[model samples]
Target: MAGNVTVDRTIVRAVTVFAMLNLLVTLNNTPSRSWMYPAGLGALGCVLLTLSVLASLRDCFRPVPTWRGIRVLTYISLGLMAAHCLTVRDLSPRDYPPLLHACGVIILTAAAAFPLPTGCVLMGTYAVGFFFVRLQSLTVGQALTECLVLLVSGATGLLLVALVRRTVSIVSTRSDLTQQEARATARALAQARERARWDGLVHDKILGALRNAAAGDSRRQASNAQTLAREALAAFRADTHSDAPTALARKLEQVADALGLECEIDIKQDQISSEVLDVLEAAAVEALTNVARHAGTPRVSVRAVIGQAAALLIISDRGRGFESQAPGQRAGLKTMKARMEAIGGQLDVRSTIGAGTAVTLSWSHEQPSWLTVLWDVRVFAPMIAIGAVDVILNVGLGLTRPARLFIPWLNPVLAAVVIGFNIAIAVCPRRPRLGWMLAACCVPLPAVSVLNLVTYGDAGWRYWAAGALTPAVGALSFRFRSSLGVSCCVASLLVLMVSEAILGRTSWAPVLGPFPVSLGVALVGGMLRRGLDGATAALSCENVRLAEQVRQAAGIAERNAEISRRRTALALDILPMLELIAGQGPLSVSEATECRLLEAAARDNLVAATLVNDAIAASARAARGRGAEVVFRCADNAQPHAGLRIFRSLVEQICATIGAGSSARFVWNGSGRDFIGTAVVLGHEASAIRAVVESVAHSGLLTVTCDEDSVLIQMRTH
Candidate 1:
């Protein structure tokens, strides 16, 4: 609808503007007394054109427009303007410029089409309009000149319009390509995360169980079975959201709860983008999973904060930390660092053997400052400026013999010094140390420059000499361990050598003496002042380090204080579990609740025990309907002594509560140090625990053997 309206408006405006221009020409050319008719017609035409242009603009801006409507509108406007031009030719009150008017109308109409062919159509229509105007006004040479100007104007306008349209097309295409890339990357990340989840489950559960079974530890074997169920739960939770950011605290709780490990999280909602959150969450889970598998640590804390311009995330553990930077030992740390950088973050880590480890990730929002601007200026700009000066001075002074010999030796030495300084700073242990390193670096080049100046009596040698001494004197003010001394001596010696060399050689003595003396004196004097600044800079570095150490020490103390408080809170939680185990009196409600938790915490985990029980009961009842021999048994060897009673009670309660009429047998047995038993649920409820356990018994493993939900089994044997 809007497209149709815009087309109408453009047609109206084109007609109106063209008529007004034509009527003005007629009035100007005809007798002033009789111009009223032409002016009135022109006024009417202007109104029509204005209305049409507006309607056409409105139409083009919207999404829906019928192909028929577009064609009808375009041809109607073209035909109307063409008819108007033909009727007005040689008929108005004055000579009419019908050609220019018609061209303008055609150009506007062609624009209404809105695509590649728009420009070509517009050019062709304007050409016909131009021919009409030229046929009316100009004679011979004037007509030819007018024709050239019209051609230039038409081509220039269309070329500009074409360029603008194509540029927009290219930009839109690039934007679509970038969006596709992001989508592809997101899909790959999702697949990788899914695989990691399954791998983690297998490692914690099946592998651990098999390892324990081989190690001959009955406790670990039972523990691994429970661990398997817990890992399955964790994998399920992680798979819940393939792309959305999962809460760090929630994910840790699920996995830690499964492994019977305690997790503490301090994360804020506004700390980072959702993308960063997902990355951190995955890394945290993986780290905790490793701890559960190897560290033997019962608890860990994960803390995260959004600094002024960076996001800081820390995962700390009170486990056996390894030696810092030990070869091949800290692959996880490397992985964590890589993850941080992938999200435009930084990782700073501190750890100690036997104490603990803190993996801190700092993510910057802005680009690195050095990379953004300063590094280029500090390193490249100077080299460029120096190179330009060297090229000009060396070429100009090559005519002199001494300059040829001296500059070659001096240039290489200077180049070596600059390269070495850059390499040293880049490889330096600490970034701030670059200040002193750069200052120290300034001394050597100046010494080489001064040596060359003394050996060769070329004025061009003065360029290298002066350039070298400047950085040296400037570097000394940095106040790190008498930085000025080496450069100062070099400058002083150059001054002495120049005085001797110039006094002995009288040929170019007048030209070189003044410059060498002035530069040498100034350098020596500047070095004296910098010697003091160098001392201050050295002291400042030490002070800064000490201040930093104090700040860090305070942070550690504060964290330790917080840890102590959390430990106290954990102690309060564990108190109920302990009281229940003591059995001094009837357990309190809280104590009874904690007892379930304590039972779960005793081995790999009992958190998944409830789910395991549900699945077992469901599977067994289904299997026993076939009336095959079957038994649901609690294995005595699953856990020894104390824990054996808890597992037994749990199994017995499950059997009694899930009652179904079926004939089955229960057997009690002891294997080595383990109290084990088997309940055989037979007939219709053979796999069902209720039929097997007609009487109650307390043990760990509840194994149901049945065929198609129907079976028969031994009533007892222990």
Candidate 2:
């Protein structure tokens, strides 16, 4: 949608540039006209055109007021140009001044800036007036031909704008979809990490304390167990409240002190998400923990740097470092890597034995490349197609009047050269260096061709080379740099002016009449390139802002979910057990053991809460009764509701294969476009589980595989 706005702005600016150039050329040729029957009316028309051009240029960059007044001025200017044509007298139409040339520019401007119905009405009105005016001075066949050319030019402009709008719409839709997908993925990962943290809390704190109280015998041991349970309950309740935001430097200092190490810290602050800060603090703590326990040295440092759309954090230590291949010795490091990747950040660990270790975490907003956007096919194709049509029309008109050429053989040779250069310009967007070189070589051809092809003072389309071939030079030059493009246009204009003066036509009409069209083409091309650059920058910044908002929202949602889960566990399981212990003296050995088992079962529900149904829970209970260990692990918590029904069916099939004295672990992971469920069972043949899994037919959305000790089932989600 932003891109569509950019396109619309570019079209408006382009129309303004072309309209001003046309008006300048018309003003230069007006006073020297020897064909106008009434001079006063012609001067009045010229003044009106001048005022309209000035108004359009003044408001080119502003978007308010909708440019309606400028459009009205342009319509009056077009009518005046047509009226000037109608006032011509005592001159054959073929020998008349090129008054209809201004009509082409006006038609293109209207078509680009106005809606279809209005643009068509304007073009039709101008075309009918021009056709009727020409009919008074020439045959009907010639008049019809000129009218057809005017209409085709207008149609070309309409088609070009339509194509640009369609392309912009497609790009905007895809960009929205991409942002939505990124947000979805970030939310899923945040939920998964939150759930994992809760699982660890339940197992290490609540469940461990329950098991200890069950096995204690003496009064002192029971007292210690009771103290531990009270501490665990307090910590569980405290975790439900959210953490207040803190500065990165303060957080790093806290982590380092907790791990019993002194860290030299350097940080530059910017607007960073709490989610990102949490990951950085966690990674720093893990790295410092390694230094305290295994690095055998206390020399460590932490550095953080924030930029416009990026961030970097590094944790370094001068200790006895281990080999890179043995990074898995610290499982926390792998976990930090996954956490960083979940938020679209990068983690790199560098180390050498007997040297030191440096862990780097970095993130940056993704941006589109300038070269790729500049050379987009949607923009380039239309320019090339329009240039080819210009060449065809110019060469066809030149060939039809062979007697007008001073050297008859030069027409075909010039045509061949122009066509070859047009082809060369088509590929210049890809290889700009070559394009500029070609542009430089052709800068002098327009002036040289005009000098050699026509006799002195001949005025019958003798400057066709400057009109036709010089535009290719303008097109190719603008693809590189702005200074070079302006230089090329001015150089050609001056050389053609000098050539016209040498040919004894000292008036500005010969130089200013045909060459402004080429100049207009160059300026429009440069404007388009600049507009694209601005659009790319805006799109990149918008994406970064949207990503930050999504991450912040996900962090808040995960916190709320954790609070709800903790409340449920406290109300249903832990509170009743504490009440029983308070009423009686203490839990008996059998009752304590039963309480520990129930807590362990509740821990399972905390880990894979979404996968728990009555049938699955009943099967797990039966398996535990038969002296089997059953565990459920879910690394991705955002599962689609539609997939849950199918996941339940497939899970039921796997549970049927579990037998006595067998340990089973079921893992659910979501990555990219697929949802994978893995079942690892020991003390049972894998082929039986695989066969059972495959028996449930799925319509190409599910696949099952079995290795020596595991049966893996994968389902496609997108």
Candidate 3:
């Protein structure tokens, strides 16, 4: 808190020092006198300086509250400066009054404390005082320029305060999120442990009592039953509330105890954020659930390590693993991965059939610096090529000059060096110091410009304009930090600034004037760099997320096709007998009853075969409505935990394509290294079946084999 407060007051302190020092400068430079008064104007100036110094000292510890007399003192001080300005006997059109500088500083200091509107008042007050003095004592142009510059300085002071306040707010917000996450985690972990304990108690005590009562059922067991009943009540009474473990090991141990898994907590760091730990722990639970439920009762191992840079959690089990992209498994992976991403972490799963499945979850506060410099250079190659060409062309033009600058071949040598650096950086840019490439781009112009100014008395503005190349390059490479970009550009400009004095010029406006533009370029670079950082992170997250979705859709489509084939088979078995009875003559009561019974039984089979997929349901309804025999069987699918929802739309498409006489068979082959769903369709010609296979096979998931009698689609669920 103290540090944040100090940061907020930095601008105020700086403005105070600026104001006080400029007052001293005024005392040294001003020539005004007050002989008629008991004390001269110089003595009065000293008194005012002493007061300002005292006020500054008080303000160092904390800002002066508005209720205090600081505002009034400041007003009085400005009034005194104005009085001094008015007393000046000689004023030149070209010279500015020293008091104007003092007024500017005082206004700047005021801006740091006051709200915007109040700061405006302070600025206006100072400007009015200075204006009153300047109107009588100096030329109109001098007065206007002083007022404008002073106002601009005051606005800059306000901007400093605003920036500081914003920084403090942003820091506070992040801290709050971290703290809140910790509290939320504590509550959730406590609840989970409490629930686990209750469950463990019931399983151990109450269920054991019931089993004991059931086992001893003879008359000799009545006393044993009574004893069991009493024991159950006693156990329930004794299972009182206890504190849930929250420290890392105890918490994880409790989880392992409840879940019946082996747990290891490797604490590399003394402390970890609860927010990060919560995310990791939750993801581990999801992974372990998948392993136990799908991995054929394999032994589960859970491990967690909290490190300095990041935390890692691993859950492994040797189980009968299915394809990682199998819809059921993919859904769990996606859920866990999304949880990790929310906390800026990565979640990954690796599995091979009959070997094992391992789910790894990791999170870090800072992004890992994973720079592919070659890729970055590839992206910027065109810009670098253009810059290289410009330098070469400039050198070619400079070669036409009959008179040499510094050396006979200096221009071409500098150009060659610059172009070499540009090409080298473009092909293989280095990470962490990418900004330094600007120095190479800067060298050609400044070296040639300075050499020309030395060799010839007349130097063109074109020579100075060439110096801007460094900043332009810096702007283009804004994503790089100071070491690689902005600082190097500024260094090149500083060389030109020093060169102007070495060339023996009285004024170095040509060199010094461009410094502000350099700063502007750096500002632009910083902003662009910041924006791209955010965009890069968001793009990466979206890429993996989209890949998961695409894999999921493919899995769903394959499942739906397989379900439709099952529905068709079930419909074939019963449909024709009903059709015969409807078309032919009247039947006996037994025949009619038998037909109704068969129809009812067929309808029940179809309902039981209905898949839990939305798209497959709609498609099945449409196919049946079109006089197609659809059969559904529970045996046609396996891997109940797999996340595939059989949508009817895919089946409808196939039925419509195959026409009215089609009979399909779906064989669910999940007892293997990968899930195999094969659909065999009859009544479609070999050519049509071949075409359908060609269209869906492009996905690299399904294989189609067609013969004269039937077409088979084998989809390998990945």
Name the best candidate (by lDDT): 2
Query: RMSD to native for every prediction?
Result: 25.9, 7.8, 16.6
Candidate 2 on 43-115: residue-level lDDT in tens? 6766776677677666666763246545866677577656655666566655544445555576656666777
lDDT of 2: 0.64
Worst 10 residues of 2 by lDDT: 368-377
Ranking by TM-score: 2, 3, 1
Writing each residue's lDDT as its tens digit, candidate 1 over 126-170 gives 556555545664454444443443343334323323432333344
Sorted on lDDT, best first, the list reads: 2, 3, 1
Of 1 and 3, which scores higher on TM-score?
3
Alpha carbon lDDT of each predicted model:
0.43, 0.64, 0.50
Candidate 3, residues 1-718, lDDT tens digits: the string is 1234334344434445555555665555455423422346656655665576567657655753221234544665667666655675454343455445555566556565656787777787777767766666555764565465455545544553454455444544544454455455534444433333323333232332333333434433333334434543443334332233235556556645544565554544446655455555556655655664577763777777776467877777777766766532243454455456655688777888878788888887664322111235444444444444444444443454345455656656665655555455445444554435445556436645564644443232234334325334443345445344555555666666566667766334333233333343344344434433433443344443544454345434433443344335434533344333323344445444444344433332332333324344445445444444445433323444231332122343564555456665444444334644556777745477567556555557676777787777766666
Those runs of model 3 whose alpha carbons end farther than 4 Å from true positions after fitting are 1-8, 27-39, 63-73, 94-96, 115-118, 135-138, 158-349, 359-718
Between prediction 2 and prediction 3, the one with superior TM-score is: 2
